[model samples]
Target: MSTRILISGASIAGPALAHWLGRYGFEVTVVELAPALRDGGQDVDFRGRTHLTVLERMGVLDELRALGTGGSPMTFVAADGRRMLHLPAEFAGGDVEVPRGELAQLLYRHSSARAEYVFGDSITALEETPSGVRVAFRYAAPREFDLVIGADGLHSNVRRLAFGPEERYVRHLGYYAATWRLPNDPGLPVGSVGLNVPGRLMSVGASHRDPGRAGAFALFASPELRYDRHDQAQQKALVRAAFAGLGWRVPQVLDSLDAAPELYFDSISRADVPAWSSGRIALVGDAACGATIGGMGTGTGVVAAYVLAGELARARGDHRAAFEGYERLLRGYAQGCQKGGDRTGPFLAPRTATGLRFRNAVLNRRWALDKMLELGKEVSSVELPHYEAELSGMAGREG
Candidate 1:
């Protein structure tokens, strides 16, 4: 019988892994906590050849290119609306940029035919038996699978259940970020424009698809905050307090918070697990090695999924060998890509006037900006083996 694999999380990494595993003839099943797919998020990009290579292997590279957002330039302004510094699109957009929600959907569609997806459910418990894993779900009856993997985000339930509490793994990086939709002002430009004060930033950009709508994004430096992840009202209050005395359209953006239908808020953090797997269970993507933002996390997630699935195919039924190989080949490379997250908070919202001035002055130089861009490509580069098992979907893939 083919191996029965259970994956938790229907986001990018989960679906991407399912696609490759299914193509390898594994019986793949994915469970997602959300009722359905999520949509309408900030732009996410892929950098370097490693990221592009995985997308090409999945056969979704052209599709993602069609959905690409031409990259958005950021303009930082003073309290009174005078532009201080401008960063071109490539700085943040990388090689190709797409909305976060859009990428999630594309991955889901690519894997749905090959994998069974159970939505609006979650894994409550897992037990490894002699030959497989006994899994319990919130809404479905208990079932067993040959292997289990967690592709959930940093706050992964699977990791918490298999590993210890989240405190042991997730470390806050002294910053918080939030985003929500707002009414378009019509006067707003194509990309992001924001007011920056010491330790805070309030930015907005009109939607590329719908000119009548806009997105509000804010970043602030804080030690560490405690709050309910599901409570939007409390999150809104925290954001309002963080920017209370700020000038330049601050009130206008805050006023829209009450009317915004959805809000995405979280601390800037990273997850570091000493071991990637235990017994019949393993982890991938943010659940394994991830940074909250500016970590090339999205790109890293897909690449890690590709390598994880390929390693399994190479090992066939020997999961221990597969997991060890996956970590061996990818850990150093993943950590190298993840280091960028450590600089995100200070870069977006400097803690002091001197730091802010230095950032603006230094990044203003074209040579400095070019040098930084070159480094991103360098860190994300990695060589990968072509897994072309006979009858595998990736068989006969173009070089």
Candidate 2:
């Protein structure tokens, strides 16, 4: 019988894993807490050969490329709205950048026919049995699967249930980030424009497809604070408090916060899991090794999902071997990519005036900017095995 695999989270990683696992003849089920596919998120990019290779294997690279956001050039402005520093589009937008929402939807469309997706529900408990895993859900009937995998984000429900509390693995990087959509007033430029003060950054950029809309991406350095993730008002208050007296279109950005339909707010954090698996349960993507932002997290998650699903196929459903192989092959590469996130907050919004000036001065130099870009390419480089070829060979044997 084909292996029955349950994957938690329907974001990039979960759906990508499902696509491969289903292709390998595994019965896949994806569970997500969100009622539906999340729409409208910050643009994510894929750089280097490793990321491109995986997308090519999945057959979604071309589609994504067509939908790519050409790039997002950023202009840092002074309080009076004069350009202080300008960064080319390529600086933030790598080889190919696409809205995260579009990517997630594409993966879902590819896998939905073969994979059973349970939305508006989540895994509440997971019990390991000799033959399989007994699972409990928030809404669905209890069921059993050969294995369970957490493709959930940094604050993964599966991880909390199978591993432990979030505090154990998540480390805040002394900053907070928030993004929301607003009307793209004529005053806002085509690309992003921002005001950066010591420890704070307030930016707004036009939508690639819709000139009528804009996105606000801001960051501020701060110690970890206690707040409800679901409390929109509270999150807005925190943002307001952080940038209380900022100037240069920041007031306008803050004004839109109350009316913004959706808000994505979270601490700039990283997950460091000692082990990616235990017994019948395992983790992939951000749930395993992830940085909240600037960590090449989206690319790493895609690569990790591909590796994990491929290892399972290669192992022929022997999860113990598959899980170990997945972790062994990806642990080092994933951690290496995560190191970039450690510096994201400081690099984007330095804590002191001197630090901020130094960062801008250094980054403004052509050589220094080139070096940083080169480093990004180096960080994204990873060796990927040809899993599709192996899967095809196994199919041939079965045929």
Candidate 3:
């Protein structure tokens, strides 16, 4: 029988991994906590040759290229509406940027026909037996799988269950970020215009496709605070408290939250797991090694999915060798990519006004912007082993 693989989380990593695993002849199943495919997330991007290569191999490169939202420009302004710093769309838009939601859908489409996808459900327990791993779900009958992978995000349930508590793996970097939708204020200009106060940033941009609605992305420096991840009211209260008494349309944006159905609020954080696997269960993407935001996570996750699936296919039934090879190949590159998350908080919402000014001043120069972009590429670089031969073998059998 073909290897049966169950992957948790239906976001970027899980779906992408499903595509590769299906291509390599694995019986794949994916479970997502969300009832439906999530939509309306911030634009995520992939950088450098390494990211592009994996995308091309997955055969979704052209589709993503077509869906690309060009590097959306962002302007930082004073409370009085004077532009302090203007960053070109390309500056933040890596090589290819698309709405995170759209990318997730595209991947799901590619693998849905071949893989069993259970929405609004999640894994509750895992037990490895001599035959396979016994798995229990929140609302489904228990089943056994040959292997399990956690592609969930930073707060991975599988990681917590398999590895340990989240405290041992995730490190908060003195900042919190929140984003939500609001009615587009015709009085204000379009595109992202942010107000940068000491330790706080509030930005809003109207959707290019839907001028009637806009999205607000906020960042603020803060020490770690305890909060329930699943409680929206508490999360909204935390955001309201964090950005209380802000000027320049912040109140209006916050007011809109009353009607907002969903909000993404979390501390900026990174995850570091000493190992990526435990017996029959393993981890991929952010669950294994992630730097929350601005850490090339989208690209790194895609690369890791490709490598992990390829390694497993190459190893046949020997999951131990496959898991080892996968971790060995990705750990250094993933850590290199993660370092960017450390700087993201300080860069976005500097603790002091002076720090904010310095960031603006340094980035204002053309050379400096170019240098930083170049450095971003270096961090994303990794040598990918050619798996085309393995793919060719699969095709030969089909022919």
Candidate 4:
């Protein structure tokens, strides 16, 4: 008999995992906390090597390419409100940009037919026996599955119950970031504008094939601030406090904060887990190692899903073997992305005014930017292995 797997979260990681798990012949069920498919947020790019490979294998590479945002150019503005230098869109985002929810929708479409999904609910508790795991949902009857995977985000309920406390695994990078969509203003242009004031950044860019709407990100350097991730009021107050004294159009941006519907605010953080799996329970994506919120996080999630589901198929439903194989194959990749996140924080938000000036100088100098791009090419390059099992019929297990 095929193993039955319950996956939490239907975002990028969960649905991607479901695609491979279902093909590998496991019965897959995904549960998401969102009432329906979330359809908003800033576009994400699938750059680096491994992420592209994952998309190709899933047969969504063409769709992703078609949906890419190539028209949005970016400009870095000085505190004095002058365009310092114009940068290609790839500078702030990546090689390509697609909305976060677009990626989620693409993943869901690929996996939906073969996998079952339960929306508007979430896992509340997980109790594992020698043979399998018994899961309790917030509003549904308990059910048993051979394996349970948490593709949930940083504050994963499954991770807390199966592993330990979140604080033990999450490391904050001393910064807070918020992203949301707002109405396009006549005052702003169609391209992106990045405003910087040493350890702070505010920007808005054209959002996913849409001209009348734009996505904005506000980031600032700060120590960890205590607030409920689910508390909208608390989050709003925090954003207001962070940018209270800023001048010019900054006030206008802050005013839009309270009214935006799809606001996503969280600490710039990474998850560091010693081991990603325990018995019949495991974690993937941000629940395992988010590697921060740039291009790398998206890529890491895609690659992890491929490697994990591939291992499960190879092990023929042996949870231990599959889990170990998954770790061995993907740990190095995760480490590389994590290192990029660590380096990026200092580069993106320099501590001192002098340091910020130095960074801007680097960006302004063509040779320095070229050198950095060369270094990035070296770090992002990886030899990906095509899972013969997935390409062929061997990986698909009949559920």
Candidate 5:
């Protein structure tokens, strides 16, 4: 009998996992909390061969390349709007860059035919039985599946229910980041333009699709503030307080906050779960290992999904063996990738003025900038197994 798998969160990781599970002939169902597929998030990039290979295997590489953002070059300016430093588009865009929303939509479209997706709902509880997992939803009737996986994200409900409270695994990385859209006003350039004042970075860039619309990206150093994630007004207020006295279009960006339709705000945090799975429930992607901004999280999540689903198929539905192999193969690579996230916030907005200046001075040099880019490529490197061979062999035997 085909293994019935229930996955939480229909974002990148969830749908990616569903695609592989369905290919392997497993019954897959994905539940997402959002009413619909989210739209308009920060541009995410896939760097190095490892990331590209996975996308190629999934048959989305060509499409993603076509949709890629040409690049988002950044120019850091002084208070008076004089450019102080510049970083090329390749520095941030990597090999392939696409708005997160577009990628999510693509993944959803790819997996929808095979995987049952329940949007506008979420898993409220999980109960593991000897044979399977019983899941309770916020709206839908309860159901049972052979296994459950959490691809939800950093603050995953599955992780919270299966493992423990969020605090036990989620670590605040001393910063907060927020993004929103505003009118591109004639002043903002085509690419990113920003001003940094010790501990805070406020920037605005033209939206890749719509030239008339601009996007705001900001980060500020903070120990960890208490706020409701659902409260957009409160989050905007916090952002305002952080950049209160800033200059160079910051006031205008702040003014747009009230009128902005949506905002993405959260503490720059990382999750380090000791074990990726317990019993019939498991965690993948951000729920297991995630870094908020700096972490090559998007690529890592996609890679992890492939491995987890492939391992499950290899194990022939023996979840104990599948889960163990998945962790053994991926734990090291995921952790190494997560290390980059630790430096993301500090690199974007240094906590001290001297630190900020040093970053700009060093990155201003071509050699230093090249070295940093090279290091990023190196971090993304991972040895992936050809799971297709194993699955094909299994099919041959069955035939």
Candidate 6:
């Protein structure tokens, strides 16, 4: 039987789920809110075990390695622009690092030919009946699908329609981040450099190959600030307002903010749902469990895609069984990732001068940093069980 599946969001998780679902004989359709593939953003990486296995299974690992940013180095600079300490290329970016937009493009190219993509459209309503799921799109007619999955990011429309409000599940980590491409490179001596003030951190780094342009991130902790997630002007204004007095090439970077075509600003937040599926609908990726920025968002998205599709195929598209198994296996890991993100927030944004100094001292220690990298590499790649073989093998062994 051909399982008709409607997937919302066309970035990492949506396309990846479509890829595996189609391979298992499911007819998939992906609808993206954006008019086209977003081709600009900061670098995201594949880290922490399960994520690496997904890339290998997708046959894109070598291609990704070829396209790697080549371990961009990062330096910590004083407010006056004096370099305090710089990390070697090895420490800044993990084993694999690529622009978020570039990676999205790669996933889109890999899945678009085999799947249906409706750009500039979104789901307005979703109704799950006994026969199937009745779906209504903002621009398309009402249709039905055997199952519906939301692979959207933190602010997922599908979650709103199927589940209750986002506020019930989302936990704000009390920080915000903004990224944009700088018109001119900051002319840094190495891969990337950051300047830290009392409550803000700004980074400037050229694309390893393309020195003409650079990426900048200005982030800080703020417990009380409200702005529309989709409002670009308002977000840009917020960034400007927050960093008005920050020094060290910030003025130059901020000067180009208005001109950059793909600037992004969002609060660091995570979502934790008791269950990812209800009735005939399921949520994947950030919609179900968002670890925000540091908890390996890219990795979690990719891994979730593989696991969700694999579980459905194994169960012959049985929503109840698949969702239950998925939750049991993935819930703890997702919680751990979210905790990692929370832990990293304090490290990334030290509240006091003493904390910042201590962080720098630890990072400056060559032996300590090397030891950390060695440990990190060891746990970053995890071997995933092949669903088909594992299921049958376990049955046979038990019998």
Candidate that would win on TM-score:
5
Q: How accurate locally, in lDDT, is each candidate?
A: 0.89, 0.90, 0.88, 0.80, 0.90, 0.80
Error of 2 at 71 (Å): 1.5
What TM-score quantifies how close candidate 5 is to the native fold?
0.97
Q: Please write out the lDDT profile of model 1 over residues 187-250, one tens digit for every residue.
A: 6877799999999999999877778888999999998988999899999999999999889988
Which is the leading candidate under lDDT? Answer: 5
Clashing pairs in 4: 24-397, 25-397, 43-98
The residue-by-residue lDDT of candidate 3 on 204-304, one tens digit each, is 99876578888889898888999899898999998899889878878888898888878888888999999999998999998888887788888889999
Q: Given candidate 2, what's the lDDT at residue 63?
A: 99
Lowest lDDT sum, 10 consecutive residues, model 3, at 182-191
Q: List the residue pairs that clash in candidate 2.
A: none
Give the winner by lDDT: 3 or 6.
3
Give RMSD to native, each candidate: 2.7, 1.4, 1.8, 2.5, 1.2, 2.8
Q: List, in order, the clash count of every candidate structure.
A: 0, 0, 1, 3, 0, 2
Better candidate by TM-score, 1 or 5: 5
What lDDT does candidate 5 reach at residue 207? Answer: 86
- Model 5 deviation from native, Cα RMSD in Å: 1.2
* Candidate 6 accuracy as lDDT: 0.80
Please provide TM-scores, in order, for all candidate models, with all chains considered together: 0.95, 0.97, 0.96, 0.94, 0.97, 0.93
Q: C-alpha displacement of 382 in model 6, angstroms?
A: 6.4
Off by over 4 Å in 3: 187-190, 391-399
Segments in model 2 whose C-alpha atoms lie over 4 Å from true places: 394-399
Model 4 lDDT per residue over 1-399, tens place: 338999999888899999989877789999999999888756677775567777887888889888877545667687678876676555645555677787888899999998999999998888888778988989999999999999987777788999999999999888888887787784466566877778887777655566777778778899999989888778988988987887746777888877888788888888899999988899998899875665377778888888888888777788889899898878777877767676555665676789877777777898887776666555454565566544465535542
Model 2 whole-model lDDT (C-alpha atoms): 0.90
Please give the range of 10 consecutive residues that has the lowest summed lDDT in model 4.
Answer: 390-399
Q: What lDDT does candidate 5 reach at residue 273?
A: 98
